[model samples]
Target: MHIKNKLSVAIILALTLGLAGCQSAYYKTMESFGYHKRDILVSNVEKARESQEEASEQFKSALDKFSALTGFHGGDLEDTYERLNDEYESSEAAAADVRKRIDAVAEVGNDLFDEWKTELSQYTSSKLRNDSRVKLSKTKSKFKKMLSAMRKAEKKIAPVLNVFHDQVLYLKHNLNAQAIASLKSELSNLETDIGKLIAEMQRSIDEANAFIKDLKKQ
Candidate 1:
């Protein structure tokens, strides 16, 4: 097989395995409810599900647009097309799988949220009971696991974009100055967006962890 094909296979396998592990981790956290925080975690899980869907759509659109722009230009487009198609298919599959995992996680989170709501209702009805710290700790760990899983997914697919970005750079170096400038500008924008997206994801995960820690003390 081509090197590009091999890379795609490896990436797909890594992403699939990591996300599956993430699902299992969340399940375990739900089972160990002493440290779980249902409300915030459920909200984050829903956000994660949405993120996965958005990412997948973005990946697909990029592939389609890139192909339209590059196809029939006839300069080693075959190889590039093959590599890109492989990357797109693999990434899409991984993203879809992650969304499925998120759905499962969300179900557990919703169940826990209902329980918390009932408990909070009782707390409001009577004297506020002592807060449970153990559940908070478990929630923090579970959030970390979700973050780690997302990081792994990002690592797996970011390389393909990096490769494409580098290719654009090479094109800029060899192509017409006007064309090069446009490509460079677009590539720069894409890199910026990717960086920003990753940063936002990290921030969300961090916020979840911090929130869980605060809940632990309550």
Candidate 2:
């Protein structure tokens, strides 16, 4: 891998590792609380907030790149800018959720982290263990390559978003069934891809937790 790619992988891995620890912290908190199968959603909300912040930075940084590579200022792309704004709003909502969850957890106790983890472990599905077992088998190099491939989709985001903006502008002046259909198709694909990534990450998280549980059993 090139140095730039290595750097990117390292950034992503560091972020991913931080996230795993955050998840572990939440699990531990829940275990200490001794709450069985309760929705300790604050961790996920925090993760979402972190994701949004990172994405916002990336989006802003990509603006310069977008202009240089595609001759497009993100400002000129109103629809795309709106999309970014929407993400910001979503992040805020997620942060709110995190606060609410924090309050709920605090009401229980300050040192309930370990109980929370134990409680969560009781309900974790065996499927998660199986899934994690498979993914965990890979060497770091292969895993990094896979992560890079997944991240490649994000590289096209600026140009793709710019095109979406242009299409919205195009629709304003010239409405056609074919164009509308095409727009929906592209948007649907984007939604599906994003959904898949989120699901995959959740599964990965579950797998990691399952591994932790296995360690505790020993």
lDDT of every model, 2 decimals: 0.53, 0.42
lDDT of 1 at 127: 35
User: Candidate 2 on 1-218: residue-level lDDT in tens?
Assistant: 89677656654554465357664444444444442222332333244334434444443443333233233323444454445345434434543443443343333222233344344456468886555444434322332343343244333343435544554555445444444455555554554444454454344334334433443342
Shift of residue 178 alpha carbon in model 2, Å: 10
Please give, for residues 1-218, the per-residue lDDT of candidate 1 as tens digits. 99677656654554475467764454444344433545435555656655655665566566555545433344554455455456555555655565565555555555564565466545543434335334534654565566565555555455646645565455535553444345445655555555565565555445545644554564
Tell me the lDDT of candidate 1. Answer: 0.53
Q: Best by lDDT, which number?
A: 1
